[model samples]
Target: MSAKIRLYVDHLLGPGQSVELTREQAHYLFGVMRLAVGGHVALFNGKDGEWLAKVAEAGKKGGKLTCQTQSKPLHMPPDLWFLFAPIKKTRTDFIVEKAAEMGAARIMPVQTQFTNSERIRQDRLQAHAVEAAEQCGGTFVPEVADLQRLDRVLDDWPETRQMMFCDEAEVGSALRLAAQEKGQPWAILIGPEGGFSDRERARLSGLPYAHVVSLGPRILRADTAAVAALTMWQQALGDWL
Candidate 1:
Protein backbone atom coordinates (compact mmCIF):
# COMPACT_ATOMS: atom_id res chain seq x y z
CA MET A 1 0.00 0.00 0.00
CA SER A 2 1.06 3.58 -0.57
CA ALA A 3 2.19 5.65 2.34
CA LYS A 4 0.29 8.80 3.19
CA ILE A 5 3.19 10.38 5.01
CA ARG A 6 6.49 11.64 3.63
CA LEU A 7 9.20 12.35 6.18
CA TYR A 8 12.60 14.02 5.96
CA VAL A 9 15.30 12.08 7.77
CA ASP A 10 18.96 12.84 8.34
CA HIS A 11 19.98 9.19 8.14
CA LEU A 12 21.35 7.68 4.98
CA LEU A 13 18.83 5.64 2.95
CA GLY A 14 19.54 2.54 0.91
CA PRO A 15 18.02 -0.82 -0.03
CA GLY A 16 18.96 -2.49 3.27
CA GLN A 17 19.62 0.39 5.67
CA SER A 18 17.57 0.71 8.84
CA VAL A 19 16.67 4.17 10.08
CA GLU A 20 16.12 4.69 13.78
CA LEU A 21 13.53 7.24 14.70
CA THR A 22 14.02 9.79 17.44
CA ARG A 23 11.64 10.18 20.37
CA GLU A 24 9.74 13.02 18.69
CA GLN A 25 9.59 11.21 15.38
CA ALA A 26 8.46 8.00 17.01
CA HIS A 27 5.80 9.82 19.00
CA TYR A 28 4.40 11.43 15.91
CA LEU A 29 4.52 8.27 13.78
CA PHE A 30 3.46 5.73 16.37
CA GLY A 31 1.40 7.75 18.84
CA VAL A 32 0.03 10.59 16.80
CA MET A 33 -0.23 8.93 13.41
CA ARG A 34 -0.77 5.49 14.96
CA LEU A 35 1.59 3.81 12.55
CA ALA A 36 2.41 0.33 13.78
CA VAL A 37 4.76 -2.38 12.62
CA GLY A 38 4.43 -3.17 8.92
CA GLY A 39 3.17 0.33 8.17
CA HIS A 40 4.90 2.14 5.32
CA VAL A 41 6.36 5.61 5.11
CA ALA A 42 8.12 7.53 2.38
CA LEU A 43 11.50 8.84 3.50
CA PHE A 44 14.04 11.21 1.98
CA ASN A 45 17.39 12.53 3.22
CA GLY A 46 18.00 15.27 0.63
CA LYS A 47 21.05 13.49 -0.71
CA ASP A 48 19.54 9.99 -0.88
CA GLY A 49 16.31 10.63 -2.72
CA GLU A 50 13.07 8.95 -1.54
CA TRP A 51 12.54 5.44 -0.24
CA LEU A 52 9.62 3.34 0.88
CA ALA A 53 10.30 2.17 4.42
CA LYS A 54 8.38 -0.26 6.59
CA VAL A 55 8.17 -0.11 10.34
CA ALA A 56 10.28 -2.96 11.65
CA GLU A 57 9.89 -2.23 15.36
CA ALA A 58 7.67 0.14 17.27
CA GLY A 59 7.77 1.54 20.77
CA LYS A 60 6.19 4.37 22.68
CA LYS A 61 9.11 6.70 22.20
CA GLY A 62 11.26 5.07 19.52
CA GLY A 63 11.06 2.88 16.46
CA LYS A 64 13.04 1.31 13.63
CA LEU A 65 12.28 1.46 9.94
CA THR A 66 13.85 -0.70 7.27
CA CYS A 67 14.09 0.44 3.72
CA GLN A 68 12.07 -1.63 1.24
CA THR A 69 12.86 0.03 -2.07
CA GLN A 70 13.69 3.31 -3.68
CA SER A 71 10.65 5.32 -4.63
CA LYS A 72 12.03 8.52 -6.16
CA PRO A 73 15.52 9.60 -7.08
CA LEU A 74 17.02 12.78 -5.70
CA HIS A 75 15.49 15.62 -7.68
CA MET A 76 17.37 18.77 -6.78
CA PRO A 77 16.11 22.17 -7.83
CA PRO A 78 18.02 24.50 -10.13
CA ASP A 79 21.23 26.10 -8.90
CA LEU A 80 19.10 28.99 -7.66
CA TRP A 81 19.53 30.90 -4.45
CA PHE A 82 16.72 33.10 -3.16
CA LEU A 83 17.87 36.18 -1.23
CA PHE A 84 15.29 38.43 0.37
CA ALA A 85 14.94 40.84 3.27
CA PRO A 86 12.89 39.42 6.11
CA ILE A 87 9.53 40.95 6.91
CA LYS A 88 6.79 39.98 9.42
CA LYS A 89 7.03 36.54 11.02
CA THR A 90 4.12 34.88 9.24
CA ARG A 91 5.02 36.45 5.95
CA THR A 92 8.63 35.43 6.33
CA ASP A 93 7.50 31.88 6.99
CA PHE A 94 5.33 32.06 3.91
CA ILE A 95 8.30 33.12 1.79
CA VAL A 96 10.47 30.23 2.98
CA GLU A 97 7.71 27.69 2.37
CA LYS A 98 6.94 28.96 -1.09
CA ALA A 99 10.59 29.18 -2.01
CA ALA A 100 11.04 25.53 -1.18
CA GLU A 101 7.88 24.62 -3.02
CA MET A 102 9.01 26.56 -6.07
CA GLY A 103 12.42 24.83 -6.32
CA ALA A 104 14.91 27.14 -4.65
CA ALA A 105 18.22 25.45 -3.88
CA ARG A 106 18.84 27.86 -0.97
CA ILE A 107 16.86 30.48 0.91
CA MET A 108 18.74 33.42 2.44
CA PRO A 109 17.30 36.16 4.63
CA VAL A 110 19.24 39.25 3.64
CA GLN A 111 19.59 42.30 5.87
CA THR A 112 19.01 45.37 3.74
CA GLN A 113 19.02 48.93 4.90
CA PHE A 114 15.25 49.13 4.54
CA THR A 115 14.60 45.66 5.96
CA ASN A 116 12.12 45.72 8.84
CA SER A 117 13.28 42.74 10.89
CA GLU A 118 16.70 42.44 12.51
CA ARG A 119 16.65 38.70 13.25
CA ILE A 120 15.12 35.43 12.09
CA ARG A 121 14.41 31.95 13.47
CA GLN A 122 16.57 29.96 11.09
CA ASP A 123 15.69 26.60 12.63
CA ARG A 124 11.98 27.31 12.59
CA LEU A 125 12.12 28.52 9.01
CA GLN A 126 14.03 25.36 8.02
CA ALA A 127 11.34 23.23 9.60
CA HIS A 128 8.79 25.08 7.54
CA ALA A 129 10.80 24.24 4.39
CA VAL A 130 10.89 20.58 5.40
CA GLU A 131 7.13 20.56 5.90
CA ALA A 132 6.62 22.25 2.57
CA ALA A 133 8.72 19.61 0.82
CA GLU A 134 6.87 16.80 2.54
CA GLN A 135 3.45 18.16 1.71
CA CYS A 136 4.29 19.22 -1.82
CA GLY A 137 5.76 15.86 -2.92
CA GLY A 138 9.27 17.24 -3.19
CA THR A 139 12.16 14.93 -2.49
CA PHE A 140 14.61 17.79 -1.94
CA VAL A 141 14.38 20.59 0.60
CA PRO A 142 16.18 23.90 0.37
CA GLU A 143 18.46 25.12 3.14
CA VAL A 144 17.14 28.13 5.08
CA ALA A 145 20.11 30.23 6.08
CA ASP A 146 20.40 32.56 9.06
CA LEU A 147 20.08 36.31 8.62
CA GLN A 148 23.07 37.94 6.88
CA ARG A 149 23.93 41.39 5.74
CA LEU A 150 23.16 41.92 2.05
CA ASP A 151 26.19 44.06 1.55
CA ARG A 152 28.52 41.36 2.82
CA VAL A 153 26.84 38.80 0.56
CA LEU A 154 27.31 41.02 -2.46
CA ASP A 155 30.86 41.91 -1.53
CA ASP A 156 31.71 38.23 -1.38
CA TRP A 157 29.63 37.24 -4.40
CA PRO A 158 31.25 34.73 -6.72
CA GLU A 159 31.73 35.87 -10.26
CA THR A 160 30.27 32.59 -11.52
CA ARG A 161 26.73 33.09 -10.20
CA GLN A 162 24.61 35.78 -11.84
CA MET A 163 22.15 37.77 -9.77
CA MET A 164 18.64 38.68 -10.95
CA PHE A 165 17.67 41.82 -9.12
CA CYS A 166 13.90 42.47 -9.09
CA ASP A 167 13.79 46.25 -8.95
CA GLU A 168 10.40 47.97 -8.84
CA ALA A 169 11.98 51.22 -9.91
CA GLU A 170 12.77 49.69 -13.31
CA VAL A 171 9.05 49.44 -14.09
CA GLY A 172 9.15 49.99 -17.83
CA SER A 173 12.31 47.94 -18.45
CA ALA A 174 11.44 44.64 -20.08
CA LEU A 175 12.99 41.43 -18.75
CA ARG A 176 14.34 39.16 -21.54
CA LEU A 177 15.57 36.21 -19.54
CA ALA A 178 14.02 33.59 -21.81
CA ALA A 179 16.17 34.45 -24.79
CA GLN A 180 19.40 34.17 -22.85
CA GLU A 181 21.12 30.94 -23.90
CA LYS A 182 24.10 30.81 -21.61
CA GLY A 183 23.65 28.61 -18.57
CA GLN A 184 25.28 30.20 -15.53
CA PRO A 185 24.55 29.68 -11.84
CA TRP A 186 21.82 32.15 -10.88
CA ALA A 187 20.24 33.82 -7.86
CA ILE A 188 17.15 35.99 -7.37
CA LEU A 189 17.08 39.01 -5.05
CA ILE A 190 13.87 40.38 -3.56
CA GLY A 191 14.06 43.60 -1.60
CA PRO A 192 12.16 44.45 1.59
CA GLU A 193 8.72 46.04 1.79
CA GLY A 194 10.28 49.45 2.13
CA GLY A 195 12.18 48.62 -1.08
CA PHE A 196 15.87 48.64 -1.77
CA SER A 197 17.94 51.52 -0.38
CA ASP A 198 19.43 53.95 -2.90
CA ARG A 199 22.89 52.58 -2.27
CA GLU A 200 21.68 48.99 -2.62
CA ARG A 201 19.96 49.77 -5.88
CA ALA A 202 22.96 51.54 -7.32
CA ARG A 203 25.37 48.85 -6.18
CA LEU A 204 23.27 46.09 -7.68
CA SER A 205 22.74 48.00 -10.86
CA GLY A 206 26.48 48.50 -11.22
CA LEU A 207 27.36 44.87 -10.56
CA PRO A 208 28.75 43.24 -13.70
CA TYR A 209 26.83 39.99 -13.06
CA ALA A 210 23.54 41.50 -11.85
CA HIS A 211 20.48 41.83 -14.08
CA VAL A 212 18.15 44.52 -12.80
CA VAL A 213 14.64 43.70 -13.96
CA SER A 214 11.11 44.91 -13.22
CA LEU A 215 8.05 43.07 -11.86
CA GLY A 216 5.61 45.32 -13.70
CA PRO A 217 4.34 48.79 -12.94
CA ARG A 218 2.63 47.90 -9.66
CA ILE A 219 4.68 47.47 -6.51
CA LEU A 220 4.31 44.10 -4.76
CA ARG A 221 4.85 43.06 -1.18
CA ALA A 222 8.03 41.22 -0.30
CA ASP A 223 6.25 37.85 -0.19
CA THR A 224 4.45 38.40 -3.48
CA ALA A 225 7.64 39.52 -5.12
CA ALA A 226 9.33 36.26 -4.22
CA VAL A 227 6.61 34.17 -5.85
CA ALA A 228 6.57 36.34 -8.95
CA ALA A 229 10.33 36.28 -9.34
CA LEU A 230 10.53 32.51 -8.93
CA THR A 231 7.78 31.92 -11.45
CA MET A 232 9.45 34.10 -14.02
CA TRP A 233 12.82 32.48 -13.48
CA GLN A 234 11.45 28.95 -13.59
CA GLN A 235 9.61 29.61 -16.82
CA ALA A 236 12.57 31.29 -18.40
CA LEU A 237 15.70 29.58 -17.07
CA GLY A 238 14.84 27.08 -14.35
CA ASP A 239 13.94 23.41 -14.60
CA TRP A 240 10.24 24.17 -15.04
CA LEU A 241 10.82 24.48 -18.75
Candidate 2:
Protein backbone atom coordinates (compact mmCIF):
# COMPACT_ATOMS: atom_id res chain seq x y z
CA MET A 1 0.00 0.00 0.00
CA SER A 2 1.19 3.55 -0.65
CA ALA A 3 1.72 6.08 2.12
CA LYS A 4 1.06 9.79 2.00
CA ILE A 5 3.60 10.61 4.69
CA ARG A 6 7.36 10.46 4.22
CA LEU A 7 9.64 10.44 7.26
CA TYR A 8 13.38 10.61 7.85
CA VAL A 9 14.43 7.82 10.16
CA ASP A 10 17.76 6.82 11.76
CA HIS A 11 17.42 3.07 11.47
CA LEU A 12 18.17 0.41 8.89
CA LEU A 13 15.39 -0.48 6.44
CA GLY A 14 14.86 -3.84 4.86
CA PRO A 15 12.10 -6.28 4.16
CA GLY A 16 10.20 -7.12 7.35
CA GLN A 17 12.61 -5.05 9.43
CA SER A 18 11.14 -3.26 12.40
CA VAL A 19 12.16 0.38 13.01
CA GLU A 20 11.88 2.25 16.28
CA LEU A 21 10.87 5.89 16.26
CA THR A 22 12.19 8.50 18.71
CA ARG A 23 9.84 10.25 21.08
CA GLU A 24 9.87 13.38 19.01
CA GLN A 25 9.23 11.45 15.84
CA ALA A 26 6.51 9.49 17.55
CA HIS A 27 4.91 12.69 18.72
CA TYR A 28 5.06 14.09 15.25
CA LEU A 29 3.51 11.03 13.66
CA PHE A 30 1.00 10.04 16.28
CA GLY A 31 0.21 13.32 17.99
CA VAL A 32 0.61 15.88 15.30
CA MET A 33 -0.05 13.76 12.25
CA ARG A 34 -2.63 11.55 13.97
CA LEU A 35 -1.35 8.44 12.33
CA ALA A 36 -2.64 5.26 13.94
CA VAL A 37 -1.35 1.74 14.08
CA GLY A 38 -1.36 -0.02 10.68
CA GLY A 39 -1.19 3.30 8.88
CA HIS A 40 1.47 3.40 6.20
CA VAL A 41 4.43 5.79 6.28
CA ALA A 42 7.33 6.01 3.87
CA LEU A 43 10.77 6.10 5.50
CA PHE A 44 14.36 6.85 4.56
CA ASN A 45 17.63 7.04 6.51
CA GLY A 46 20.01 8.83 4.10
CA LYS A 47 22.08 5.62 3.76
CA ASP A 48 19.32 3.23 2.67
CA GLY A 49 16.77 3.53 -0.07
CA GLU A 50 13.27 4.69 0.58
CA TRP A 51 10.94 2.07 2.07
CA LEU A 52 7.21 1.74 2.51
CA ALA A 53 6.54 0.97 6.12
CA LYS A 54 3.48 0.24 8.22
CA VAL A 55 3.07 1.68 11.65
CA ALA A 56 3.20 -1.29 13.96
CA GLU A 57 2.81 0.48 17.25
CA ALA A 58 1.81 4.05 17.95
CA GLY A 59 2.04 5.84 21.26
CA LYS A 60 2.42 9.29 22.65
CA LYS A 61 6.00 8.64 23.73
CA GLY A 62 7.22 6.31 20.98
CA GLY A 63 6.29 4.21 17.95
CA LYS A 64 7.48 1.43 15.67
CA LEU A 65 7.26 0.68 11.96
CA THR A 66 7.74 -2.40 9.83
CA CYS A 67 9.20 -2.16 6.40
CA GLN A 68 7.11 -3.91 3.77
CA THR A 69 8.74 -3.02 0.48
CA GLN A 70 11.33 -0.79 -1.12
CA SER A 71 9.77 2.30 -2.56
CA LYS A 72 12.76 3.87 -4.30
CA PRO A 73 16.48 3.33 -4.51
CA LEU A 74 18.79 5.84 -2.87
CA HIS A 75 19.57 8.53 -5.41
CA MET A 76 22.76 10.32 -4.41
CA PRO A 77 23.35 13.89 -5.41
CA PRO A 78 26.43 15.09 -7.26
CA ASP A 79 29.63 15.74 -5.31
CA LEU A 80 28.59 19.34 -4.76
CA TRP A 81 29.32 21.32 -1.62
CA PHE A 82 27.52 24.57 -0.80
CA LEU A 83 29.53 27.13 1.18
CA PHE A 84 28.13 30.41 2.45
CA ALA A 85 28.48 32.86 5.30
CA PRO A 86 25.63 32.73 7.81
CA ILE A 87 23.40 35.78 7.74
CA LYS A 88 20.47 36.47 10.06
CA LYS A 89 18.84 33.53 11.81
CA THR A 90 15.88 33.20 9.44
CA ARG A 91 17.90 33.73 6.30
CA THR A 92 20.56 31.26 7.35
CA ASP A 93 17.84 28.69 7.96
CA PHE A 94 16.42 29.43 4.51
CA ILE A 95 19.83 28.88 2.90
CA VAL A 96 20.31 25.54 4.61
CA GLU A 97 16.82 24.38 3.65
CA LYS A 98 17.29 25.32 0.00
CA ALA A 99 20.72 23.73 -0.18
CA ALA A 100 19.36 20.38 0.90
CA GLU A 101 16.45 20.64 -1.50
CA MET A 102 18.72 21.62 -4.40
CA GLY A 103 20.93 18.49 -4.30
CA ALA A 104 23.88 19.79 -2.29
CA ALA A 105 25.84 16.89 -0.86
CA ARG A 106 27.30 19.04 1.89
CA ILE A 107 26.49 22.43 3.41
CA MET A 108 29.15 24.58 5.04
CA PRO A 109 28.93 27.90 6.88
CA VAL A 110 32.09 29.92 6.52
CA GLN A 111 33.13 32.86 8.65
CA THR A 112 34.24 35.64 6.33
CA GLN A 113 35.91 38.89 7.36
CA PHE A 114 32.57 40.65 7.06
CA THR A 115 30.40 37.82 8.42
CA ASN A 116 27.76 39.06 10.81
CA SER A 117 27.15 35.92 12.82
CA GLU A 118 30.20 34.37 14.45
CA ARG A 119 28.41 31.35 15.92
CA ILE A 120 25.91 28.97 14.32
CA ARG A 121 23.89 26.12 15.78
CA GLN A 122 25.07 23.34 13.55
CA ASP A 123 22.66 20.81 15.03
CA ARG A 124 19.67 23.03 14.37
CA LEU A 125 20.79 23.68 10.84
CA GLN A 126 21.26 19.96 10.32
CA ALA A 127 17.68 19.40 11.40
CA HIS A 128 16.59 21.97 8.89
CA ALA A 129 18.39 19.98 6.20
CA VAL A 130 16.59 16.85 7.28
CA GLU A 131 13.20 18.54 7.13
CA ALA A 132 14.03 19.94 3.73
CA ALA A 133 14.85 16.47 2.46
CA GLU A 134 11.66 15.06 3.90
CA GLN A 135 9.49 17.70 2.33
CA CYS A 136 11.28 17.88 -1.01
CA GLY A 137 11.25 14.11 -1.74
CA GLY A 138 15.02 13.86 -1.45
CA THR A 139 16.58 10.60 -0.31
CA PHE A 140 19.81 12.21 0.88
CA VAL A 141 20.25 14.82 3.59
CA PRO A 142 23.26 17.10 3.37
CA GLU A 143 25.56 17.51 6.36
CA VAL A 144 25.81 21.05 7.74
CA ALA A 145 29.32 21.83 8.94
CA ASP A 146 30.10 24.06 11.88
CA LEU A 147 31.18 27.64 11.39
CA GLN A 148 34.80 28.04 10.23
CA ARG A 149 36.91 30.94 9.07
CA LEU A 150 37.04 31.43 5.30
CA ASP A 151 40.84 31.64 5.08
CA ARG A 152 41.32 28.50 7.18
CA VAL A 153 38.81 26.58 5.04
CA LEU A 154 40.59 27.69 1.87
CA ASP A 155 43.94 26.70 3.28
CA ASP A 156 42.81 23.08 3.59
CA TRP A 157 40.91 23.04 0.32
CA PRO A 158 40.95 19.81 -1.61
CA GLU A 159 43.09 19.92 -4.73
CA THR A 160 40.58 18.13 -6.91
CA ARG A 161 37.38 20.00 -5.89
CA GLN A 162 36.65 23.11 -7.94
CA MET A 163 34.98 26.12 -6.32
CA MET A 164 32.54 28.56 -7.97
CA PHE A 165 33.10 31.89 -6.26
CA CYS A 166 30.21 34.34 -6.83
CA ASP A 167 31.88 37.73 -6.71
CA GLU A 168 29.67 40.71 -5.85
CA ALA A 169 32.12 43.11 -7.39
CA GLU A 170 31.78 41.40 -10.78
CA VAL A 171 28.14 42.29 -11.31
CA GLY A 172 28.50 43.25 -14.95
CA SER A 173 30.95 40.43 -15.76
CA ALA A 174 29.84 37.39 -17.67
CA LEU A 175 29.11 34.15 -15.79
CA ARG A 176 31.70 31.86 -17.29
CA LEU A 177 30.82 28.34 -16.07
CA ALA A 178 29.18 26.47 -18.94
CA ALA A 179 32.49 25.13 -20.21
CA GLN A 180 33.37 23.43 -16.93
CA GLU A 181 33.32 19.65 -17.17
CA LYS A 182 30.61 17.81 -15.28
CA GLY A 183 30.61 14.72 -13.00
CA GLN A 184 33.37 16.07 -10.75
CA PRO A 185 33.57 17.49 -7.26
CA TRP A 186 32.50 21.17 -7.10
CA ALA A 187 31.51 23.83 -4.59
CA ILE A 188 29.61 27.14 -4.76
CA LEU A 189 30.73 29.94 -2.44
CA ILE A 190 28.46 32.89 -1.52
CA GLY A 191 29.88 35.78 0.45
CA PRO A 192 28.37 37.55 3.47
CA GLU A 193 26.17 40.63 3.54
CA GLY A 194 29.10 43.03 3.52
CA GLY A 195 30.67 41.04 0.70
CA PHE A 196 34.16 39.53 0.60
CA SER A 197 37.20 41.43 1.78
CA ASP A 198 39.82 42.52 -0.72
CA ARG A 199 42.28 39.95 0.54
CA GLU A 200 39.68 37.21 0.37
CA ARG A 201 38.73 38.07 -3.19
CA ALA A 202 42.37 38.26 -4.29
CA ARG A 203 43.20 34.93 -2.66
CA LEU A 204 40.17 33.24 -4.17
CA SER A 205 40.93 34.64 -7.60
CA GLY A 206 44.49 33.36 -7.47
CA LEU A 207 43.42 29.84 -6.56
CA PRO A 208 43.77 27.48 -9.51
CA TYR A 209 40.58 25.65 -8.68
CA ALA A 210 38.38 28.71 -8.01
CA HIS A 211 36.17 30.07 -10.80
CA VAL A 212 34.95 33.55 -10.06
CA VAL A 213 31.62 34.52 -11.63
CA SER A 214 29.02 37.23 -11.35
CA LEU A 215 25.39 36.40 -10.62
CA GLY A 216 24.08 39.08 -12.95
CA PRO A 217 24.08 42.82 -13.52
CA ARG A 218 23.24 43.46 -9.88
CA ILE A 219 24.49 42.54 -6.45
CA LEU A 220 22.11 40.15 -4.70
CA ARG A 221 21.61 39.57 -1.03
CA ALA A 222 23.58 36.72 0.50
CA ASP A 223 20.61 34.34 0.54
CA THR A 224 19.53 35.24 -2.98
CA ALA A 225 23.07 34.82 -4.22
CA ALA A 226 23.21 31.28 -2.88
CA VAL A 227 20.04 30.18 -4.68
CA ALA A 228 21.10 31.94 -7.85
CA ALA A 229 24.54 30.38 -7.74
CA LEU A 230 23.18 26.91 -7.11
CA THR A 231 20.63 27.19 -9.91
CA MET A 232 23.31 28.44 -12.27
CA TRP A 233 25.79 25.70 -11.40
CA GLN A 234 23.15 22.99 -11.48
CA GLN A 235 22.05 24.08 -14.90
CA ALA A 236 25.58 24.42 -16.24
CA LEU A 237 27.62 21.55 -14.77
CA GLY A 238 25.47 19.94 -12.09
CA ASP A 239 22.99 17.04 -12.30
CA TRP A 240 20.45 19.12 -14.20
CA LEU A 241 22.54 18.94 -17.33
Tell me the number of clashing residue pairs for each predicted model: 0, 0
Residue-level lDDT tens digits of model 1 in 183-235: 66899999998888899999999999898878988989888989999999998
**C-alpha TM-score for every candidate:** 0.96, 0.98
- For 1-241, candidate 2 gives per-residue lDDT tens digits of 7888999998999999999999999999999999999899999999888999999999888989999999989989999999999999999999999999889999999999999998999999999999999999888899999999999999999999999998888766655678878898999999998989999999999999998888887769887888888999999888885
Candidate 1 vs. truth: CA RMSD?
1.2
lDDT score for candidate 2 against the true structure: 0.92
Quantify how close model 2 is to the true structure by its C-alpha RMSD in Å: 0.9
User: Best TM-score goes to which candidate?
Assistant: 2
Give per-model CA RMSD: 1.2, 0.9
Cα lDDT computed for each candidate against the true fold: 0.92, 0.92
User: In model 1, where is the ten-residue run with the lowest total lDDT?
Assistant: 174-183
**Runs with alpha carbons beyond 4 Å of true place in candidate 2:** none
